[model samples]
Target: MQKINVLGALLVLGLMVQCKGDKKSVNKVESNAPITEVTESVVDTTPIIIEKPENIKVPDGMVWIPGGEFIQGAVPQDKMAMDHEKPAHKVKVDGFFMDVTEVTNAQFAKFVKETGYVTVAERAIDWEEMKTQVPEGTPKPHDSILQPGSLTFKKTKTSVPNLYDFSQWWNWTIGANWKQPNGPGSTIKGKDNEPVVQVAYEDALAYCEWAGRRLPTEAEWERAARGNKSESIYFWGDDDSILSQKANTWEGEFPVTNNKADGYEQRAKVKSYPPNDFGLYDMAGNVWEWTSDWYNTNYYNELGAVNGPVVNPQGASTPYNPNMPYAKEKVMRGGSFLCNASYCASYRISSRMASSLDSSLEHLGFRTVATVDMLTAN
Candidate 1:
């Protein structure tokens, strides 16, 4: 109920205070090969060959992205460009399959029912683990504050809090999860088709594993979101003045008011808006999706230019948030219903966001990708 303090030393501790969240790492798999010393003549020359993985049939309710070269990142001098989206670079991605829409509530429910999986929000907080995150002597938050729950967006009236203070509108409500998106006493009974909200990165990964898929990388997501128009600022076209039901972004004052011009104040059913050129739906708004790559504010600068595009470029190997060095955050794309031109205009295709891996909020969710191996059935 109180506005979250942006300058607090325990800011990372309040990461779940949002319609958005972030992490400090993406947990890359590391291979440790044993070192073996060989005699001068022990090594014989042998041909080493690598084979391209075979592509498999596209899954149901998904679309194929016939990958090719595309300009990645925001164009130079973009009016809405953020510092992180600068130094647009060329990236080449291989063809892959992407979900036609975000994972729906019904779809997630099926996964939970079949696998008996529990989301991060459904689990109780570990004070022991959390204690290490705070200053040594910081008092433990109340038991009720530590109860199992997710962050939910609560509308504000009259004046808005400091623009940077997200806790003004984002409440860490106990008992909020995928099943009950708005916290206790809320339900998704009649909203089977709506994109599932309040899912953390791990929960999304679990569903991806059960569905035999994986989360898309940052490049893959940006490539898909851009569709056929590489130069357009938005997924629909160049014009940012008119949204026109193409996405489900906030229509009026952000956090405080929504005109509902898009016909929904909060989340809308997947496919309720128009699909991008690749037959993909909701690439711009509705929910900020998770990506596999780690985030770095200066990642684009790291990718120096080359004659050819950087092939299938994954993001930075390790997450580096100068703000929260300890929290593991991943790349988030496509903004959410809370985005508004008057305030948060993160709906731009090139706009970037990061969130803690454990964040589960009402405006955050994800879709999956079918890698060549997963699609090929191994």
Candidate 2:
């Protein structure tokens, strides 16, 4: 067995990457008016009406976000917002389409049957790759040998913590993958509707390629999540309180005891809850969606005062916050069923998180995205 640092491989790729075409165009607007005040009673007889296109139906179980500019990041007043979400900036995204729900067990199984695609957890690790990740002089013990790894929840109180330590609910169990999600003895015999878990970043990429789509970049994901709303904390607004009827998140004493108020103690069906303003479901909770950007805490600080960054195809190479651990993990957006008010509140649309490249967890899943081509006059 060999040890290879996944971050090193990514850094190598980042160096050779070429600048791609700019996705957002810069525009300037001018207005001239004299300051004046009018009383509410001054209005005579005027009617206001708005219209929208009727043919804007997104693919079934999906939503079309007419991309534009929005303030991205945290508000100065939010005490709970992480520092990474600071220095709010404006971001403009082109029109694109996104999944209304995360990829479910049934969908993943179909892909497997059609392409015989084995998840990273199911495949044996290559010795050469392993050697590149692990540091020299580290003992290559038999227990540490490459094997299938995925997230698992310990139902027992003694085995799991009641707090936000992910290590409590997530474990790298050997022989755990899509088929054997709970280690060797478990099987996906009846969980066809559940979101597919135990998938690595590469596994997701493979699925995207097979489906003729790609993972959404962090910016694109955020835009889709915001819908047509202004710069707000959540996809809906600045509210942080959990609405029992809206999402599928934890609703009791953390890991020790779940009240199941949301009608679920574990993963729920993808479309179990109400959809967002754009008719997208499970965007706030259920499972975190993967993004193409690397995790960086201060990336927003570089964006302009309007909260928009320069139109660049790729994200920063280094993590934004130097005080934090070196970011070897890719970004995961949208929270999961495990997210609760007490722990891991990241299920919000703007919340961000990351995981090791080779790591897999039952609580993590992903959705697909594609560019929306506008019909042009020939």
Candidate 3:
């Protein structure tokens, strides 16, 4: 217990915090619309590609996406777009089988070496399910900050003061799970293709129920991160000028200068870069995935008030974040390596966020999807 302090303020008052558990006491949180970046230069078009499902059968590491319609939310010409990714609505998704990356660390260490399992950051927090997400009594946090850890990102020597003060770089390390990402002696050995960072969303739904597959519906992860490049803003179309050859972001002043310059300063391996026109790969930046929906900052204004195309939305049944509204979020989608276009560019594709299904970080990771009756029931 007790390790969480690289100074993300005491790593969020400690307990390797921000596993979102907090509500009932918020004073004024009613802010959503000012996130508009639109630097105005993107007009490439010509993508409409959608291919895969030609003879069907696709399985192996997985790829097939293909379904149709797009416009999920706010990449209307992304300068960064956000306000819960806005009324850039009209959705629809049905052609499945995804995973061509971001589920590595040797496939979650082979589903924890055949299901011995134990992950929500290596277990141990239940303050009676975290004192019903803090407010009423909220007292129980002392066994040196209640054991088992996860958050881990700590790297700043100059620029902090804001980026919403994510403890200036998140720490809660303890043993920083997913094979010691930066805690303990730190290893993931030869990296084993990176992507399995700390994992929680019920440990990516117990590794998508031991690998049959699930967790993609945020309209199937914005239609496989928009492979058809809908109106394009990147899914290999809107020219971020090949953004570091196609995403692994945070190249400069994020938590005081990443300077990894895309050679990787955190979470890279999953395809290392280059795959979007539907082949999939890291899907945006390197981490921050997990979908099967929920986090509703007004669920895209109720799916942009549904005039049509909202099929397969499975998202806003609950969980809202007027900042916190007491915790329980989900919908995560790409954008990690701390993302930066001067802060949270979220590697573009309608970038959304809101994590906390008992959050886990290091960068966050997920990637799974399937159909054909979930691979014909395995």
Q: What is the TM-score of each candidate against the true structure?
A: 0.85, 0.76, 0.33
Show where candidate 3 strays beyond 4 Å. 1-11, 14-60, 69-90, 93-97, 106-171, 174-179, 185-195, 198-217, 222-296, 302-304, 310-320, 324-353, 356-363, 367-378
Candidate 2, poorest ten consecutive residues by summed lDDT: 22-31
lDDT of 2 by residue, 226-264 (tens): 776665666667665545577778877766677888898
Candidate whose lDDT is highest: 1
Error of 3 at 267 (Å): 17
Candidate 1 lDDT = 0.75
Could you give candidate 3's per-residue lDDT for residues 8-100 as a string of tens digits?
Answer: 213445433332322212212245622222112122233333555455578788878876777787665675675667778776555777888
* Candidate with maximal TM-score: 1
List residue ranges in candidate 1 displaced over 4 A: 1-55, 305-307
TM-score, candidate 2, is: 0.76
Return whichever of 1 and 3 wins on lDDT: 1
Model 2 scores a C-alpha lDDT of 0.62
Per-residue error (Å), model 3, residue 367: 4.1
